[model samples]
Target: SIWCLKSKNVPTSGCTFYTRHFLCFSVDSPSRQDDEHKLIARYTTRLPLTLILHIINFDANKQKRELIAQLESKNREILAEIKRLRAEHDAVCQPSPEKGSTNPTLLAELRLLRQRKDELEQRMSSLQESRRELMVQLEGLMKLLKDEEQRQAVSSYPFLGNTETVGFSPY
Candidate 1:
């Protein structure tokens, strides 16, 4: 189902060996087909069958080298990206005067504002409590004024309390 292209012979030890130099191709069926019946050609070669094994090993080694190279490239890219991100983080988190404004001044201003806000809130709460107490006192004073007016009116009309003047005109 698989086939190699170029062939070169190399002498090793006491025998000649063939080295594979081209890419392999896969075939579902043979390149040539007979008209009468399916005549599939069996692959034949002058070189030893061990040449196929050597070719397969070479291809595997080449693929392994390529994968290692790609992995190394990706690792370098990731390391560079990490370095860039760390720099950006430092730039944002660590403020300097050269970057624009003074950090200590800004922090001090923020603290002062927060303290002022707290003081104002406390003062407002005290004022609200004082207002409530004043309102209660005002209500008590109003009730006292109404009772005194009623007493004065009853004293000024003393003859209205006499029940014996039913048929007498004492005007």
Candidate 2:
């Protein structure tokens, strides 16, 4: 069984774990170093422990499925917007009955529509750039996810030291 300080017979009532830059494991140990059993490393990012558990269960297939779903949804929206813009462009391009009339208002409307088209084109370009960056990020995450899956598989047996990758490596 486990041991604690409240009494030689008393075991840890319970424990809680959290994640930041590194995982933190707090137990009810009444050791001399820490009478309260509280041990927190240097502060860093505050990623919840629940998210870590989710990452623990991820597989390569799941990643692919989620990426595909996102792309499908994004493509549908883009297609719809492109269709709408094309209709607007066509309307502006159409020849009016007053072809010889020098109407300032018509010219202004045409200019405004052209400006809208330029804005749409710029947005599309940025979206494409964002997609490329996301793909790169996804690739890096996949490698880390695969490694985590392997570690979970290996820990089927008892671990000698801390199973948590919290401290520095020996090598």
Candidate 3:
């Protein structure tokens, strides 16, 4: 059993006090102690620190998937915009009987369209680089987390023998 206490004012006499009791268990009983120890051992063996690392890895994988989807959507949008711009430029460049010549305004608009397309291409390249960097970082973090979990598992179970003495250096 476990008990919890909550109070607004701090105790000044260096004496501890308990309030708002939630649970009470008799730890004086040897049977209870044995049961608690058995429970701890069972739980630790079945779900060790490695489980935490697995959960983190799963989350990272999910994020990567989401990022890929977003990147694809963005690329589609950029492509559509470029197509629309090209159509508009073509419409402006159509020959007019009144002028029967290339208009300066149409030429400037075409130049602007080309500039926008180039900018979009540069942005796409940057996004690709960012995605690659994120993946590399995620891989490194997972590896470090795995190594830490293995170290924790070995430390938790003493009966498995001293990992360091056995030449099993986690580092």
Candidate 4:
């Protein structure tokens, strides 16, 4: 929904609904029109601040969730890749006893495969480290998301999460 704007290239239609609502009023009775205008003005002044804040917070929460999901998916893919790499490395590094006995070139090829296997192991270690770091970051972000959600829930009571130091406590 955020990707597609309803008003494309229409240079900032400032509050289209309010504009339409404003246009519908009758000007035949000047006093009543003035009262209606005042009411609409009050609504215009008060609505956007709270509404926009809520929308912003909600959007931010959704984006964080999306990022976490993407990271989790990538982590899973990396795990699968690591598994494949391990299998390939094992196959290459552990040649059968009978296979390399007669052929000198096979011995040479086995040496090269072992080197490639070492490189693959190194790469796998790095990916594993990266996965660990990503998991930590994901956990921290999830905690933050939960805290933010709780804060929003009890926003009416601003002091809910705070500790009261009443009647002089010794630290």
Q: Once all C-alphas are superposed, what RMSD does model 2 give against the true structure? A: 40.8
Model 1, poorest ten-residue lDDT window?
35-44
Give the Cα-based TM-score of candidate 4 against the true structure: 0.35
The C-alpha stretches of model 3 lying farther than 4 A from their native spots are 1-101, 162-171
The local distance difference test score of model 3 is 0.70
**1-171: candidate 2 lDDT, tens digit per residue:** 332322221223442223222222234433634533332221112446766567766765688889999999999999999999999898767757685256778778879999999999999999999999999999999999998876666565445235457563322
Q: All models: lDDT?
A: 0.67, 0.62, 0.70, 0.68
Checking candidate 3 for backbone clashes, the offending pairs are none
Cα-based TM-score, every candidate: 0.35, 0.33, 0.38, 0.35
Separately for all candidates shown, the number of backbone clashes (residues 3 or more apart, or on different chains) is: 0, 0, 0, 0
Q: What order do you get sorting by lDDT, best first?
A: 3, 4, 1, 2
Give the root-mean-square deviation of each candidate in angstroms. Answer: 15.6, 40.8, 38.6, 34.4
RMSD of 3: 38.6
Off by over 4 Å in 2: 1-101, 155-171
What lDDT tens digits, residue by residue, belong to model 3 across residues 1-171? 442222323222333455552223354655666655555565555565788688889999999999999999999999999999999888657656554445778668778999999999999999999999999999999999998988778778775556557777544
Clashing pairs in 4: none
Put down candidate 1 lDDT per residue, 1-171, tens digits, no spaces.
554343334223323335544334354545423311211122234556798789989999999999999999999999999999999999877867675455667778779999999999999999999999999999999999988886676568887445346653323
| Off by more than 4 A, model 1 | 1-102, 160-171
